[model samples]
Target: MTEPTSNKPFTEQTVLITGASRGIGAAIARRFASVGMNVVIHYLQSHEAANETAREAMRYGARVLTVTADLRSVDQIERMQDKLAQHGLIPDILVNNAGISHYGLLSELSENEWDEIIGINLKGTYLMTRQFMSAMIERKYGRIINVSSVWGISGASCEVAYSTAKGGINAFTKALAKELAPSGVTVNAVAPGVVDTAMMNGFDASEKAALENDIPAGRFAQPDEIASLVYFLALPESGYITGQIISPNGGWLT
Candidate 1:
């Protein structure tokens, strides 16, 4: 595999991370920012939270901008792209980290619930990727990282809808990687297990402890840990690693 000609330094690269208002997305934004890369924090409604993350990122001396868009809407996404273009912040890296989770028996899941879950978790990734991929292909150098879940690989009993969406994301990552390979754009997914984010709030303390005990690492992964992995994947040296679904599950699924 031939590497793309290095056009810009890492410090000059720009990364756009969706759902970056908080949690893992925020961490990933900060991770990229620390290296002096421009960061675009995209949020659906968490404007205040997004600004908070932007402020934190700016402390690292990186340029930070926050954009709001409903990922489910193509028009909104286009508007966001226009805004970014106006600011000269077209992203060199795209991180599809915006997703929602659902927990319940498949039989108990309502149609609306299913659609909402699938729309945000799966369709949102598709829309964002479709919108931005052309630019990456034109530039011949880009990193597209999708934040996935361990449940996507090993089906979770209660999280059927969530698992299915992430599974689709995993598949999307792999297929797109192959399609974009010739263009020097690497596509990959980071599937994490039991992260200590608000997403885990549904589990009480005891439940959290039980889940932690099941992992050989004896603890849930910190957001920063996942962020660090994503940061590594975005590096120019990681150009050759594509079409891979890397699970950082702390020995939960080997």
Candidate 2:
């Protein structure tokens, strides 16, 4: 295993995490903030939740800014970029953790539902990456970490749409990593299994217990655990570790 690089100081870096109002995204933001890096917490409509996350991050003595934008909109994202530029916060690290999970039978899924899932999970990632990658290429330094799911690697039965979207993310991560590696930008994905976040609220007590029993670890992962892996990936020493789909799934799929 390669050690993390420290050539770049934490205080000099900035991170932008989407869907960071709560759950895994919020944890990732806090992880970066804990190191005193500038943090940009992006949310679609969770203004108050985002603010709460911002407050927590700021307590770590890192500059925190909350911004909102519909990832599916080019104009909004551009405007968001403009706002970040105004604040002098061009992200050195981009965490594409903003996504939604859909759980339902494929046959019963509506067209609109499918579109929404793909649009937010896959398309949104593409757009955000396209928007910020140029600067990283120019500077020859950047980290792009996509928050994928274990289901993306091992398909889930009832979550066909969600699985498909995340599968696309895995492919996107690999291909983009190869393309950006030459430019000194590393692209990777963190696919966690059964994280204990609001996303799992749909399951009841019995369901949660059954799922845990299925995993060898016998428990769901914490958001901070996933965040730690993301943080490690963003390190300068991890430059050689690109084009990988790192699933921290507690022996669930492997």
Candidate 3:
């Protein structure tokens, strides 16, 4: 369909989502694909899973590409960029959804564990955004949507490292949004609450139910629900909304 009169048509634009092999990332790829938009799914080690996502997106006749790269390495990211350039798939929208979760007591957490969490969640977002944002700035029209967590807003107890990394993402979104605003590139973060993804595997059935009861909605959110919010933020109509951490956590946090 139709997009804002001021911007390119949805069919002509491309979206690149990092860590898109499964869960929220995959949901986002499918969301864009539903509208027949160009979709690029980036994964670290999920070749098969990425291909599966590509197949699903192809059902809507979207141009889909799967690229594997370690976001922690700039060299790999540069290679990924080169490959996309060869395919004429420069992204109009960049979703820094690639991240990892950490659950442990701060006392028990090793320095390496802390580094890994920050590297993937915070540093990876920074690297990916830095790599792709120049093209968007050149066009003076783009969307940068970060998939964060509600814990980022209200820190979690056992998930100190995860919370810290996501909190960094929240801050990054705010600061970068201002820098990119004059260029007509909007930057925002979607901090979702508990979702029914593998990220919740650490919690047992009883723990999950207890957590769900704590949420006003009485259930974990589905990945698609978060994807819907992301899709909205990427729209031309949402140009006015930037530098905001919009959390869809079923009223789990204000």
User: Which candidate has the top score in TM-score?
Assistant: 1
User: Which regions of candidate 3 deviate over 4 angstroms?
Assistant: 1-7
Q: What is the C-alpha RMSD of each candidate to the true structure, in Å?
A: 0.8, 2.3, 2.5
Alpha-carbon local distance difference test for all models: 0.95, 0.93, 0.94
Give TM-scores for every candidate, taking all chains together and pairing residue i with residue i. Answer: 0.99, 0.97, 0.97
lDDT of 3 by residue, 1-254 (tens): 22223357867899999999999999999999999999999999999999999999999999999999989999999999999999999999999999999788999999999999999999999999999999888887899999999989999998999999999999999999999988888999999999999988988899999999999999999999999999999988898899999999998998
Tens-digit lDDT track of model 2 for 1-254: 34333345766798999999999999999999998999999999999999999999999999999999999999999999999999999999999999999888999999999999999999999999999999888878899999999989989999999999999999999999999977888999999999999999999999999999999999999999999999999988788999899999899898
- Those runs of model 2 whose alpha carbons end farther than 4 Å from true positions after fitting are 1-8
Report lDDT (Cα) of residue 213, candidate 1: 92
**Residue pairs that clash (backbone atoms under 3 angstroms), model 3:** none
Indicate which candidate wins on lDDT.
Answer: 1
Ranking of candidates on TM-score, top first: 1, 3, 2
Worst 10 residues of 1 by lDDT: 1-10
Segments in model 1 whose C-alpha atoms lie over 4 Å from true places = none
